[model samples]
Target: MSLHAEPEIRPVPPRPAYDGTSPFPRTAPLLRTPGARWQLAATAVIVAFPFLAVVLAGWVLWGNVLGPVDVVLAVVFYVLTGLGITVGFHRLLTHRSFTAAPALRLLLGVAGSMSFQGDVIGWVATHRRHHAFTDRPGDPHSPFRYGTGVRGQFRGLVHAHVGWLFAGDSSPADRYAPDLLADRSTRALARAFPALCVISLALPFAIGWAIGGTLHDALTALLWAGLVRVALLQHVTWSVNSLCHMIGERPFRTRRHDRATNLWPLALLSFGESWHNLHHAEPTCARHGVDRGQLDPTAAAIRLFERLGWATDVHWPDPRRLDGRRQ
Candidate 1:
């Protein structure tokens, strides 16, 4: 009989420690609620109104009855609302490119409301989604989604410019914007979007009636300040999605698939958002136009806020970081 040898026991390795990081954490599934569809429909109506007004203005202008007051109202409202979206919504809210004092935050929220581009929360959620899935399947508005061919590109451009908003898929705010969702004040303002819309449309008429003392003045102001201004701002904001992606210089390198560009014509109107190539490369940076001679009004506003002690924690672009991203 052979003597049986005891089987050798191998020592087990110690279990890895839990460092509390996750590549893909558990997320709540997206909800396809009816409210989202209604909200989208409302958005479409608001976006379309400006275009309709523009056509009306062209007709009136050709008829040679448009007034100087109309021009003044349109110019004034356009600048106010445009700056609100760029300085308030994009720079201050979405990117936190800089911090703002509570009073400044409230004022910005109100000013942006005057733009009538939905409330701050919805805008931020949609924008964050755009960045998260830019030019990809989940992107809210990607001009390249349809394809690269001419016809496909044409269709994609339209989709990116404004068609995507009509689509009935609301981005889950919880998944993308927990910071905003957690803020009680912001949520309250967002829920008051319908009220904001009412005020946005009414304020111009009120101002015109008060200034000019006529129903004609009120109607004209409504058309010029409310409708025309909204349309111009909409296109400028949308162009960052369509034109900025389709044209301009790309000095900074980005993730291979991201297709942002710097189209200069849009620089002033978009409040320096046309420095899109740099924006896509460094989204959290307060200044999109980091290069010398690239004028950025939004950055200047943030700087002013900082100087006044109203803002802090600004994510200014570092030269070293720019060097790393240079093409």
Candidate 2:
């Protein structure tokens, strides 16, 4: 499709007449679609290759192939792309936690795209749907998907972490992200996702070659800064979908069956996104780590942007709202 061509937006089905049997509306199918093996294969490669790269990186570390430059590059990319997802995709695009300047918005979208997550629109759409359904049946990656039992939880944990990506039941961009679809710039960025993925790898490789002046340096940077970095961020984000709900303190009340939690160990890695309970409680809040002693780098970044005039109208936490949501 052409870059400027509008994305096809699937119509969200209208709610069926309520019979008072369930509060939850009858929703679209979760996983009955078939004949998407190509999509499944592609997802496997995207999910598996980075993991295999981590194994390769460990062996390379054993051989002393790892370098300080590679480590620095990895750290830099991780912070940039990680913020892209947390700040740009989740907060800005998905929930409108704040308004960003056009340039900053584009930059964040590109950076988040480089994180090797899905495109900006699809990511936002899927996440919005996740919020709309939460831990209920329509949630794309809920850990309680199977049931409350131990075996079901185990199966659900896997499904939530990575298995859901291969389920072929894609969230409809039209239904969930019509705003992005309507915007020419965002549409172009969505179209540029694959090329951005290549650049995500290439930038590190080129930087390493320029700095270290060797093919070995380039390849090592590709392995560490490119693939390993992606793998770490991928799993960290996935953990919020899996581990956060299953294990942690729920300090805030959420919708019925919403089990989002505050997993402190993941706060830094997820850029404070693992403060899942507060996020679900206040989806539009710019700060997920609202409580004292929580480190929220994503919120900090958004604050920096606001201070610099790149961001405006941030949905900073309200004490009254917090008090009401407290469990």
Candidate 3:
């Protein structure tokens, strides 16, 4: 089969409105059972190592000044992988906010895989599941999972931010990502995830070595541009799952129990994903920060893609729909 062949689009199954008194239906059993020791260990390493690198980075900064090379590399890689997650994984792949050329689609999947966020198919599937159940039962990660009480909310926030990664209940791609599974290109990209992760680190290291001509410089680049960059982006993404659901303005109304919010503080860092309320209200909209003066680099990138004929059928927001969803 042609790797560039467009796969059939499969619409997500409709979910019932959440009844306040009852839990949403349980999802099918995961590909792996809950709490596999190896998976837990890997997750712990992935989460902890990056944070430890941040601490190391601070110490390095204290002892020897941080170089411009490291800073530039960090920012560049962060934007590359960050947009990979926002524009590629979320908008193009998961939500189908726009249709991209096959080459662009492959580039995005590869870029996103390097972010250490998991395979594209799995990421899309989990996110789709999150939307299917929202903040109610069956949501893979929800800040309200523990309830609204003070202590419960605190614990829920932690769970939503990073604890959910350890929950061990994987979203089954076969169920939630049938379209990607059918696409030969995506399946190949998923298989290359581990290699892409290595390249993510190696590329920074090689660049640092070439530019600085020292092993120390290369190691520092691996730390800042690789581990620290991953940590920052991961936490920013997680913050949306946690803080965005618990605070800030809720100008747009979402489904019952969907407490997504528009948090400006995170707008620049999250590349406008902090405008979470509108996203929950209109999942397919190519633009999340749908207001004057609101920053949405992802949407801007999509606009560029549309102008270049690389993306089509873009789901630009409708003012009527936005007005109807306003709280």
Tens digits of per-residue lDDT for model 3 on 131-231? 87789887899877677778778888998999989877777788788988998989999999889988999999999999999999999999999999999
**Candidate 2 accuracy as lDDT:** 0.86
Looking at model 2, residue 188 earns an lDDT score of 94
lDDT of each candidate versus the true structure: 0.78, 0.86, 0.87
TM-score for each predicted model, relative to the true structure: 0.86, 0.90, 0.90
Q: Compared with the true structure, what per-residue lDDT tens digits does model 1 show for residues 67-136?
A: 7777888787777777778878887788777778998887788778778778888788788878866675
Superposed by TM-score, candidate 3 places the C-alpha of residue 3 at a distance from the truth, in angstroms, of 28
* Candidate 2: tens digits of C-alpha lDDT, residues 205-242: 99999999999899899998999999999999999999
Model 1: lDDT to the true structure: 0.78
Model 2: which residue pairs collide?
Answer: none
Residue 116 accuracy (lDDT) in model 2: 89
**Model 3, 238: alpha-carbon shift in Å?**
0.5
Residue-pair clashes per candidate: 0, 0, 0
RMSD of every prediction: 12.3, 5.7, 4.4
Off by over 4 Å in 1: 1-33, 62-66
